[model samples]
Target: MDELSALAARVWGELAQAVSTRGHPWRTATLATVSPEGLPDARTVVLREWDEREQTLVFFTDARSPKVQHLQHLQHQAQAVLVLWHPGLGWQLRMTVRTEVTFEGLAVTSRWARLKMSPAAQDYLSPLAPGESLQGLSPAGASRPHFAVVHARVLALDWLSLNPEGHRRARLCPPERAAWLQP
Candidate 1:
């Protein structure tokens, strides 16, 4: 591989490793999207899956969440940015991606099957929608069916590395190009 390809591959390697490495810095990423009102919204989200070959990342969220609503409002042309920072390595990756949201499908069923038995499932079981006001005691629900899966197809990734010796930056767009940028 050439120098640029090698560097891009290394970045993808870190992302793949973060999928199952709980302590990895990229395990939690900041997802930023534009709401229907043209306002920017950002939130921290867990890294559930990653595929280097497909240039894709996956995460789970509540179907009723504002993020979902934002993506849905954009429909087929939904675009978002995912930012990952590694304090230990002094590296940061900002990925531009096209997003797709699935409320029910194999993606949702399979993920739900694995998640339903875990404590994290409680996040989707709330009686009220996300950001709703809490008044009286919470009511118990049998099964909260608000699980949603988001698939992000990475279009380009801007990687920056900070080091005491020097700093480096690159922009990687798979299949065709990877170029170094001024840092």
Candidate 2:
């Protein structure tokens, strides 16, 4: 394999690790998207799944959340950026991805099955929509209807390493293109 392929493989490997490794710095990424009003919005989100073959990343969110509404407003074809940093490796990865949202399909059902039994399920159980004012300890709803899954197809990846000796940067457009960039 050539140098660029090797580097892309290494970066993909770390992204896969971030999915299953709790507390991994890359396990939580900042998701940046454009709101319905055309303003940029960003928030930290847990990394749920990664598929190297498909070049896709996954995360769960409330169906009524602002992020979901934002994606819907854009017709789910808009591009979003995910930024992750690995403190231990001194590396940062900025990925440009196409977003898709699933609510009631098998994709949502299967993930909800696994999550509904865990404490994390409470995140989607709130009676009020995200950003709505709470009314003093309101009881959570009993179902998982609010759960939604976001599947992001990575279109491009920009990787940067902050090494003590020398910094390096690279960009990968996957399946075919990769190039080193000046840092």
Candidate 3:
């Protein structure tokens, strides 16, 4: 492959290796979304899936989640950001990708129902809906019969690596030429 592809591949290798090792404990990333007023919001969530062929990432959250509300308000901006850091590797993925809520599709429900969860984990969903202020500690100890699971899928990642040895900060952008910029 060409230089761009080579660079991306090298970084992807680092990501895969780092993710598989015990060097870094920062596995989960902060997903950031912006509202219409240019306000910022973020939440810490687990890494659900990754597709190498499509170059995408996925995670799950409630449909009525505050982050989902912000997403709905954005309407036209279909992209959301995921900030990941591997301090040990001195690398980060300023991941930019298309975000879509997966729930209505039949296949989606099947995947949801198959999720491995404990009773305590299921307690997060209280049937009372999200964002609704509850009366007491009752909701905190409640559980839904069958919790709804919605996933946010992201595609197309932009990676940046810091080479402290050479004082180099390089960047890789896709679908075009990749260049190293001082960021």
The most accurate candidate by TM-score is 1
Tell me the tens digit of each residue's lDDT in model 3 across 11-35. 6665455444544434577888887
Model 2 regions more than 4 Å off: 140-144
TM-score, predicted candidate 1 vs. hidden true structure: 0.95
The list of candidate 1 runs beyond 4 A from truth reads none
Supply candidate 3's per-residue lDDT for 74: 59
Candidate lDDT scores, in order, read 0.90, 0.89, 0.61
TM-score for each predicted model, relative to the true structure:
0.95, 0.94, 0.74
lDDT of 1 at 23: 89
lDDT of 3 at 54: 63
Q: What ranking emerges by TM-score with the best candidate at the front?
A: 1, 2, 3
Model 1 lDDT tens row, 46-115: 9999988789999999889999988889787899999999998899999999999999989999999999
What ordering of candidates by lDDT runs from best to worst? 1, 2, 3
Q: Candidate 3 regions off by >4 Å?
A: 13-26, 119-124, 128-135, 139-156
Could you tell me the lDDT of residue 173 within candidate 3? 49
